[model samples]
Target: MDWVRQNLGHLTRGQIFSIPTMTMIEEYVRRDNQFIAGPDQKYVCSSDDLAEFNIPQGISISTYDRSNVIKLYEHTVFRHALSYQSDSPRPDRLASVAEHKGKIVGIAGASEDSELMWQVGVDVLPEYQGLGIGKAIVGTLTKRIINEGIVPYYSTEVSNLQSRQLAISLGYKPAWIQLYAR
Candidate 1:
């Protein structure tokens, strides 16, 4: 144990030790982007396709935020998506949003990879709940992911039946339940 004891001081000083955590997330993001940006082989929702549906007035889709939208997004999607993290120094990639009269109603983000994993955050602002906005946004987002030739996947906690049902409605099946290594 002398060797361990001697190295403890050096190790505690934040000496560079090679590990996969940093590269893991980085590679994961890369794979996702490559997947999403791939050929539009699958069929995601298109602008023309959405036009057929009656998109309510005062609602707009974009990727902008005026307030602490980043924090809000991390909090919202993390409930279901185990991989949805709030780690510092986030990757600068996310999805568009659906706004209503200068307020956010729904949000979504897609990480680029061979198969893009997407999270569609539908926030009804307490007053706009159950107005089919969430469904429309998720549907639009999922269709886009599929069209990119990458399989679309969503994550939700087992207790979140409502979110899971929403994923099912969007034709997403249960991929797997992740067990973390504590």
Candidate 2:
């Protein structure tokens, strides 16, 4: 707990998600640019400009304050990658979505596992991936969590370098590594 305190900040008791407790997110991902990498941050963007940022052209993005729409994503396809549900009561979660032709092709979610730890999860459709959609949504969500004064962390399978790199590109450093049996 001491290490958590020294690195990640503390959360006062009885605190819930509220406007007063929230701080303004620095960049919510404007219409033009999606993942705006910070100064000296080489992991964030494949390119500086949105037009060249690698996302497939003619895509639309959105974010939600609730997880309701997560149910809309295909469960069979994304279930292994994303576990949270719009109606589940276990972990408190919210989501962001990227659409192509009005279909949800990508989603990024944040889950509050503990008062001080918020874990992030993301899923991009197999057909629509490799185009920077993962980084765009995840980076935006990370920034939004930072705006709320909470540090966001991630966990991915050892073989999933894409997932790991997405987090690293968003300015998250590996604090520790773990190897456990399922």
Candidate 3:
């Protein structure tokens, strides 16, 4: 806490989480023998800026039932889209799954992070990436969340350019940054 006070005390909430500031914080924590988890960027789309997005051609997107979603939790490739932990306070609440030739190829899942916010995550099978699967599913789910009167947010590691691009393409803008120490 003292390190944060010394290094970030002067900055506004938004500025404190900038890349340069996080880099310095990471260095300081390393010297203190603690490890930084992420300098993750959080993105959000407002109801006004979030326009309707068309589902990609040949890809069918639909909501998954809770039981089916639980089965998907066992698949590691879908880790980003679904949380398997039974004890988690933010369990997966809704999912927009993409199907290609009757096989599930991508997913956009959401967790109710707070009363007014839902956090979305996406996963696309390796063979299906770059086909607009990620963007379509995430965009579909974001609109659904917004219609429900909740704001949807997405977060990705700073280095994950592809993931960040997917969010931006779906009308999300960087809203904040966060780093955790473990």
Could you tell me every candidate's TM-score relative to the true structure?
0.50, 0.60, 0.82
Summarize candidate 2's per-residue lDDT along 1-182 as a digit string, tens digits. 56336532455532312233222111233333544322121122222211212345777777765436456445445553355454555353556677889877887777776666666778889888788888777776666666666666667764677777776766666665432211
Residue 177, model 1: lDDT of 53
Error of 2 at 129 (Å): 1.3
Residue by residue across 50-159, what tens digits does model 1's lDDT show?
Answer: 33233466777754322333554544533321224445233213454668877666665554433344334434445665666665666665566555554555555556
Candidate with better TM-score, 1 vs 2: 2
Please tell me which predicted candidate would have the highest lDDT against the true structure.
Answer: 3
Worst 10 residues of 3 by lDDT: 65-74
Cα RMSDs, all models = 13.7, 15.6, 3.0
Error of 1 at 66 (Å): 18
Off by over 4 Å in 1: 1-58, 63-92, 112-124
Name the regions of candidate 3 deviating beyond 4 angstroms. Answer: 1-3, 11-34, 65-68
For model 2 the TM-score comes to 0.60
Give the lDDT of residue 63 in candidate 3.
81
Question: In order, what lDDT does every prediction score?
Answer: 0.47, 0.58, 0.84
| Model 1, C-alpha of 6: deviation from truth (Å) | 32
